[model samples]
Target chain A: MRLNLRVWRQKNGGSEGAMATYAVDGISPDMSFLEMLDTLNEDLILRGEDPVAFDHDCREGICGACSLVINGDAHGPERTTTCQLHMRSFRDGDTIDVEPWRASAFPVVKDLVVDRSAFDRVIQAGGYITATTGSAPEAHATPVPKADADSAFEHAECIGCGACVAACPNGSAMLFTSAKINHLNVLPQGSPERETRVLDMVAQMDAEGFGGCTLTGECATACPKGIPLPSIAAMNREWLRARRKVKG
Target chain B: MAVSGLIMLGYLVAHVAGNLKVFFGPEEFNAYGHWLRVMGAPVLHHHWALWIVRIVLLAVVVAHAVSAYQLSRRDLKARPTAYVHRRKRASYATRTMRWGGIILGLFIVWHLLDLTTGTLHPGGFEEGKPYQNVVDTFSTWYGNVVYIVAMLALGLHVRHGFWSAAQTLGVGNARRERLLKLLANTLALVLTAGFVSVPVAVMTGVVS
Candidate 1:
């Protein structure tokens, strides 16, 4: 199979970038999207050209590193992350346009790579349990309701791929932020820092220069893990409560 | 238009309630109007305070517009290169948001100038006659019709705007989102009819 590629090429963060066209021949339909890219890069190296730089680790899709906005959809046309996407999704003569996530906070590094350290900063703001480790307790010592546990696990599935941020119109990371907030906030272990966590995370999110969530649900639509938009609403309630508590 | 819109809605409710006093005749209505002017007497003494409120509201409006513009541009960029036909799943009100917002924005500017400042009136209002200008304006069939239409647009805009802003700001839960949606729709209908009735009644000589 032959695939026409219009891949974004940027030398560094400050450099102007454009899509450079390349043709990849003899691609296997069974090959994964990353495998196809690997074949192309092999060809580029053979021709003494700088191959496209893209991020991929654990090509199994758990690392959330293989980020690309294929055509226009983040992580390609599928709801899954880019690594999970197979080349069979494209036809023999398809012309795919690939680019890095375009957001001020997630600036382009080089080629398809982007600096998603902002997401890490947001997580570090409060996306964790503050409880200290001690002697091991019984499993049911601090049991949570089954429903709450289930919901927490659902939000916990978020891989921090930055796809939600990339897909959002405002480039908001609210879905990602809320998932982290709710993942802990719903648990008994996350209660001590609940109020402080919401306030700090929200402030950090704002300081990072991410846009506010518009509830377009595009983030959820683009999310590989199916993180619901309702989690954002939960975060909002928590933030409001936290603010009022502090003020009082 | 998210934050400023919510603020504008708050102002609208108060404004409409004040205007409804006209139904009780000029003295009561004018007294109500006089109270608003007098309520700000303490702050009114300071020239900067009034400008501050105006500036803040202006800033909020600008923020709303700027955010909306950015979102609109991003939305255009999110579509895939290949054209895939998807069914229109958005609600009617949601679909008309961009155009409705633009029209409502234009109407708000016109409204502020017409009512707040007497610029829309040819000879301006008589020294003690703010309500007179309102009556005179609504007395005209064309003016009344235009006002009614604009109010209707505002009502529709607010209907969607209220819940949309709530969701955007992250205040929505399943139960609360549904309740807010219902409340917003009901308030919009009532407010639209309330404002529209005054002009229509004035035009028909039902309110003098």
Candidate 2:
């Protein structure tokens, strides 16, 4: 199969980026999207050309490392991660426009590779339990209701792929931030610091230069993990209660 | 945003209830208008409470619009470069928010000019006859067009805004979300119908 890919090419964060086109033929339908990229890189290496630099690790879809906005979508046509997306979704003579996640916080490290360390900073600000380093706690010690546990686990599935940020028109991190906040707040173990946690996390998220959520609902649609849009709302409620409690 | 937003919502509900008085005929509508101006008559002087309500509403409006504009500006700054290949992942109401807000903003100015100040009324602008002024404004084709359009925009705005405020203010959860959504849609539908009915009734010569 023949496919044309117009990918974003940038020398570094400081350099201006532009779209570069490449044509690849004789691709197998079973080849994964990343593998297809590998074939393209092999071809470029043989020609002594600067190969397209992309980021991928543990390409089994769980790592959330593969980031590509294939043909305008965060992960291509399908609602899955880029790693799991197979070449079969494309047809012959298809022109795919590939670009890195576009956001002020997510600057391009190279071609297709971005510095997602901003997410790390947001997580570092809160996205954690202040558990002391020790042996695991008894599961029966802190009993959690099935409903709360399920909701928490659902939100816990966020892979931090930056798709929510990329998918949003305003580049808002509300989904990501809310998912993190709800994941811990709903759990029994996370209740101790719940009030302070949301405040710090939301403050960090804003400090990182992310956009405010205006109930757009785009992030949830583009989310590969199927994180619900209500998570943001839940977090907003949590933030307000926490703010009021603190003020009182 | 959540605070000012709820304030506006409260005003909408009250305004709608008050507007519905027109259905009771001119006498009732005029009485309702007189009641609004003199609600706290002896205690706080005539129209004092009305002026206070106006001041609060004006303050809320400025706060809502300013915060929204600031947030929008930051969003623009966050994405200096637009997406090369954009797709629609959000809902229609979410998509139309910015434009809808602008349309509603313009409509508010027109509404105040036509009714409150009587500057844009097509027919004779009666100074105190709220019911007559409303009928005259709706009698014009352009008046009907503008009012209907603005009301529709308001409906869409409220549909999304109501649900959003619930989430922001922490008034909803997963189980109650569907209920909240239904309420949002219902509020939008009912408000749109209620507000548009006056103009529609006038155009159909039911009110005149």
Best by TM-score: 2
| Candidate 2 clash pair list | A237-B170
Candidate 2's fnat? 0.79
10 residues in a row with least lDDT, candidate 2 chain A: A130-139
Please give me the DockQ of candidate 1 compared with the native complex: 0.20
lDDT of 2 by residue, B2-71 (tens): 7897899889989998998898899999999999999887898899999999999999988989988997
- List the lowest-lDDT window of 10 residues for candidate 2 chain B: B86-95
lDDT of 1 by residue, B38-126 (tens): 56667575345545666877787788788788877655543322222123323566656678778767876877667677677534555
Per-residue CA lDDT of candidate 1, range A44-73, in tens?
999999999999899887888889888878
Please list the residue runs of candidate 1 whose C-alpha ends up more than 4 Å from where it truly belongs after superposition: A134-138, B1-4, B10-105, B112-118, B121-156, B168-170, B182-208
Error of 2 at B186 (Å): 0.7
TM-score, chain B, each candidate: 0.84, 0.96
Mark the regions of model 2 whose C-alpha exceeds 4 Å error after superposition. Answer: none
lDDT, residue A177, candidate 1 = 94
